[model samples]
Target chain A: MKTAKISNPSIVLQLDGLTKKIGGKAIVDGLSFDIAKGEVVGLLGPNGAGKTTTMRMIVGLIGMTSGDVRICGQSVRTNFEQAISHVGGIIENPEFYPYMTGYDNLMQYKRMTAGVTEARIAEVTRLVGMQDALGKRVKAYSLGMRQRLGIAQALLHEPKLLILDEPTNGLDPAGIREMREYLKQIAEAEGIAILVSSHLLSEIELMCSRIVVIQEGKLVTIRSLGESETPTQKLLSISLQVGNAERAQELINLMEDITIARADALTNRITLQLRQDQIPGLVGKLSTAGVEIYRIEEVRETLEEEFMKLTGGNRIA
Target chain B: MRNFTGLLVNEWLKLSKKRSFFVAYAILAVVFGILAYAFYELSPDGLNSTVDFATGTIMLQAAGQLVPVLAVLAAAGSVTQEHRYGTIKFLLIRAQSRNKILASKYIISVVYTLTLVLTAAVLAVVAGYIVYGGGAGESTWSDFLTNIASLAVYSIVFVTMTFMIGILTKSNGASIGVGIFSMMVGSLLVMLLSRYTITKYLLFSNTDLSVYNGEGPPIEGMTMAFSIVILLVYMALFLSVSFAVFKKRDIA
Candidate 1:
């Protein structure tokens, strides 16, 4: 039996034309992608763009209206148990027995996963910064803390691929930062593939190595971060605090191959778009013209902007 | 087998956490307690009359039926609760086979029902003896044992039916509502249908335990041994249908 091998890059998950429908409307239409081991791939999309629906189909939670999903070379519909054993996921808000302590919840999950030792449980608990809170009932946990425990449970089996949906939804800035670092540690240290879905493209930019963007139940773009050979248009935003911002705006208008928006006196905000190489030259010219540049910082358009561009800005703003 | 045990433990943990469990048990207990008090008050002559003997046995049988009622409620949440909470995905991704999960749930539910029935039967019997001061009431040990055995079979059948209900209906509210309503109204419906003699086989009419006087013809054509066999067959049918439906239903 010749199976489709996705190369030696340690392919953890692959979805082929996964489609789903509910109530006479298609939710996910022919979605496909590949996630490699030790890589964090962000599933970026709008609220109803079918990212979560795709994840659900891949994990065998929802049946596909058509198409297939494979994890670690095992087809979910054909070899469900074998395929699913390599997958760990927390969809939407992670839930547990509220009456039970976080440790007890993990213990129950540990009982179902094979070859996961108690020591491993302790390790993941510490990794998520929940070791001190492991003995507390989940009912008392903040949403961020519960999300950490959710991640802990997902890692308990040391699965080949981990899928988390909107994990940073309710987290404060510090908690979100901790989750970003902790997820990186898991991917790098354990060599597990991670697929995270989020509306925060800045977070995705800081984490994922590759990303799949979905728009209205269809694939918009699949691009690699910091690498891969796709040369899409480069976008840049500039923030300036200067003398006579109107004069600076006049210079920006005279320049070719750039779109500029000037700030009002009340707001003091300016946004500019130009080719990657042109940004420094424009900044230099503005500095030489005695604009008394309080600050001229170059801003790279985040995954969020790229996504908006790819989908023609039809996403939920 | 390890996975089976794990699923069983999961089901037990989940069932124990439900609020309906405590409420159901409390209601059943109050009903039984009221019956015990009434038996003590009405049989002031200490059940010396044959009429008192018959009524006391009927009440015991009524309590026996609660065994099935509680079993249905207890098993009702097995699948539907997970579906409601959107945790079926978590369970599906576990390292256990779906077949094992369903089987473990069925076994644990039947065990729960049987234990409840045994407790209720023993309590009712002790209460009956205390209130009526029986001389074994013209019944032999073999006859009493046979009745207990028959009730055990009935309990298994009811548990299996409840499991099927959980599988057939994808919502806890629907499954529990139907299971309880069936236990209350099923016999009446069956009797109505029994205008055609073939429908008599469908009714769980073996509940008329008072008719077993240890010397009579065992209630027309009813035999505890035969009832046990028929109930087992019915249970097997319900189980097969439930498994098939669960295997085919979409997880979402």
Candidate 2:
């Protein structure tokens, strides 16, 4: 195996035409992506969409039939030790020896990798907010706490890339929020590239800076979240409930910058596409036209909606 | 090399932390104690038997047979429990290669087996000294040394076989079942097949290295060197198959 040198410092993870086949059937075909440092990318796909398979391949937990994954310029196929040294991943669930204390679990990993000192372990434990529970056996830990300890173990070696598959699985609302905040903090604080796969679209939208959606073992799209505004982007969906639904529909249709996507006569609801800035003027025009608007709310395009549209109504979890 | 050592230490830590190992040792200790009391009470000459005989009998029962069973259980569980508990994922994603990981596990199983056998031998010697007043003279030392050496070799065979079973089956129950079956029925099969020329090279027939020290080989023509060679061959075969399958199979 030849050692690979890093020519590009910004890109922390690179997948080049990666493919896996079993029993003459392609599980992940020609899947490719690049994750840059300090960026959190969410991997979204429907059931059996090969998301887990892709993550496993990247981590070298499962062999790929063709192609390769490069972590910090080291090819996983040829230089496994060097490539994997730059990676920390939790495939499906974070599992540890339940009989061992959380600190011992972390120590087990620390021993496997070089330069992971006692101070580093302590620092990572504090980073994951698992300092208090370090001495407790893993069997006594909650799922959220175990997830934190898993992250701490992954971070012990200070890898350039961190891959978490469903990091927020089985967590309560508060636990989910805490995890999201911690992941964001870790990405920024450590400048580590994070690739997280999750079913929670709303959480993904909040947590990830970019979304890579795949379906049927293929890349569907890669969309950037919270990008700077550009010209010629004026479509926004705004839903309205008013007393005079027919008049509101006619008024919205007559407006210059707005077009009604859908209108219900019985429910007195209207969905209009217009510029976000034009909402106030549209509402004014509606009221001036004797349409009593009871509620006017922007129908934000959630990650779920975008994912559903891209996947053609396939359910993602 | 450092990472390999670390992996071995990690595996040892995991095995040591499990309550089952301690429980197994505790039970072994109690059984040794009870056997010592029985030897003391039931002696016709009232604890006048030679220490060699008492220690020899205890060592034969514990090291020769009982410790091998414990070693089998340990070896099987060392690999199978990782899969059963889904902790194999944790090890697979580490910076070390799969070969290193598997090698560490195999080495640890060997270490654990030796430790169990040695501990049982020590406990038996202690019980012999406590029950029977005579010290272990030169003859007893030779006997104990030879017996322990043979038991150690037997442990290697038993552990390697069961470790292969664990890797192939990836289940503790299945591996233990196969191990126990081989231990009980394997010798019987060897006896029934002894008339055939090929039975001289059979694994169970060659496992008892004690035959060299006047225990008598089940087959007449088999020598100690021949049995060692056969055991080594079987060990190589079992280990090669384990590593090949482990390296190729996907961790699901």
Candidate 3:
């Protein structure tokens, strides 16, 4: 019930040894992370990895069995009002009173909260591009609109930390892109920290600056996205369609700074990972071996493969 | 206390937006109207005890029969629907604590119950006037004042019980089912068990505050003071269980 200590002055949210147990089982165990101002941190985990449970604990929607969640150095266990005062959150899918208009729904939030001005309301509505739809009843709204209105209400108070649980769960490709854009804009314009949870790394890769990977109710890794690597230092994976895959694999295996990642003799296709500078040499070696190279194209390491490496082969839902 | 008024206003707006409340109130209004018309048509001549009929029958039916059902729906729905729709998260994650939020809903449930009771009192007076003219039920005002007062004391206990049921069940259909079932069957069971000494301790037995106003206790040797004390004990039990569970439980 004490305030959690912050290691960095810029940190807006701190979770220290956060845990939740039900029926003598830990749903989220010993989970801890920090989100600093202006950073978009993604909570990445497979299905039932406890992403939703962790978010619920932080926002006080669910009580924690142990440890503390701190916002602006205020403990959620002891000082709930002040601790939650600095947080704006959406748990799971956004829900509202369906019979009320979106505007009235926002007004309901405005009334319960202090220091939320009419101008601030207008700004948040505009921020979400929901100004025109504000007068429409929530029952008449689509899922995407509900998500935006949920964000709109969360932003109305202008908290230092924003937590969104599965923000793009039901959106189409276009709506997902729009949501990602809005999140990026909010983080930059408001200069606040945001924690977004999702099971898909593709969504997180596009939206988050850093990723906190969780597996089986534990932290697997915390990695910064877009780690800066010079073109020479980076390894590129290239799939080569050749006349004989066996000949290409043998030739590529002998080359320096290049390794065969996958070789398929049936399709005569082999994927190789090597430095960008090694591509020309790899091609020359294959050609001299009289292995006809039909096609060679680079392949981005996909979400599945990235997660497989992190989780050691557990499937992400 | 920081935004208690805001919480009240929010809960009121929420209840006001519920279409069922409008449907319930409208149906009550139509039923009241029909009762007035039936009396007007049946008695071309004014009844001798029109004051007794209006307050005792009409007002009692409103407070006793109609108010419990509607008030239970409102009170139970006020708590259960938040859990159903998952808006409870939005309600709890703000600057307001759970205690203040629950207090606001409880207060509104009481306010809503009183409002329904008062509306019935007004409608009863109007119905009596339409049937027998203004001067016929002269004592109707004093009678209704006492009747509504007892009804308030009588129905407030149910409002609290229904609100607590909503918290316990966390489902509209379930809470309303149990609430109305408890009201109807609890009274029936009290009557069936009235000869037993333990019946005096039942909620339904003590809920009728009219015993203090000369209607007499449901059981022998039960005083007005005893009934009041019993009602207080039940209300305290209902409230403490609900508040404790709501404050301590994980919303998930």
Candidate 2 Cα deviation (angstroms), residue A51? 0.8
lDDT of 2 by residue, B1-252 (tens): 787789989989888988776876776688778878877778644334355644465444443477778888888988788887788888888788888888999999899888877777777778777876664343556766788888888778988999999999998988888987887787899989988979988899987777788668888888888888999999999999999998887886
The number of the candidate with the highest TM-score is 2
Instruction: Write model 2 residue lDDT over A1-317, tens digit each, in one string.
Output: 44344457798998888999989888898998889999999999998899889999898878999988988888988888888898888876788899999989998999899889999998989888888899999999999898888888888899999999988888899999998998899899989999999988899999999999888788999989976573346677789999989988777777786788899999999988887678778878987888898888868777787888899887543
True contacts kept of each: 0.56, 0.73, 0.83
Can you tell me the CAPRI class of model 1? acceptable
Query: Cα deviation in Å at residue B89, candidate 2?
Result: 0.9
Instruction: Output the TM-score of candidate 3.
Output: 0.91
Q: For candidate 3, lDDT tens digit of each residue in B29-83?
A: 7777887777667763435344644676444444347876788888888888898
Interface RMSD of each: 2.2, 0.9, 0.9
Instruction: Flag clash pairs in model 3.
Output: none
Candidate 1 per-residue lDDT, tens place, A220-263, comes to 78888976442436565667777767777877788888887556
CA lDDT of every candidate? 0.74, 0.84, 0.84
Off by over 4 Å in 2: A1-8, A228-233, A242-257, A265-267, A276-291, A315-317, B44-51, B58-63, B135-140
Which lDDT tens digits does candidate 3 get at residues A32-148?
888999999999887878888899999998899998898989999899999898899988788999999998999999988888989999999988899999998999999999999
Standalone chain B TM-score for every prediction: 0.78, 0.93, 0.91
Error of 3 at A52 (Å): 1.3
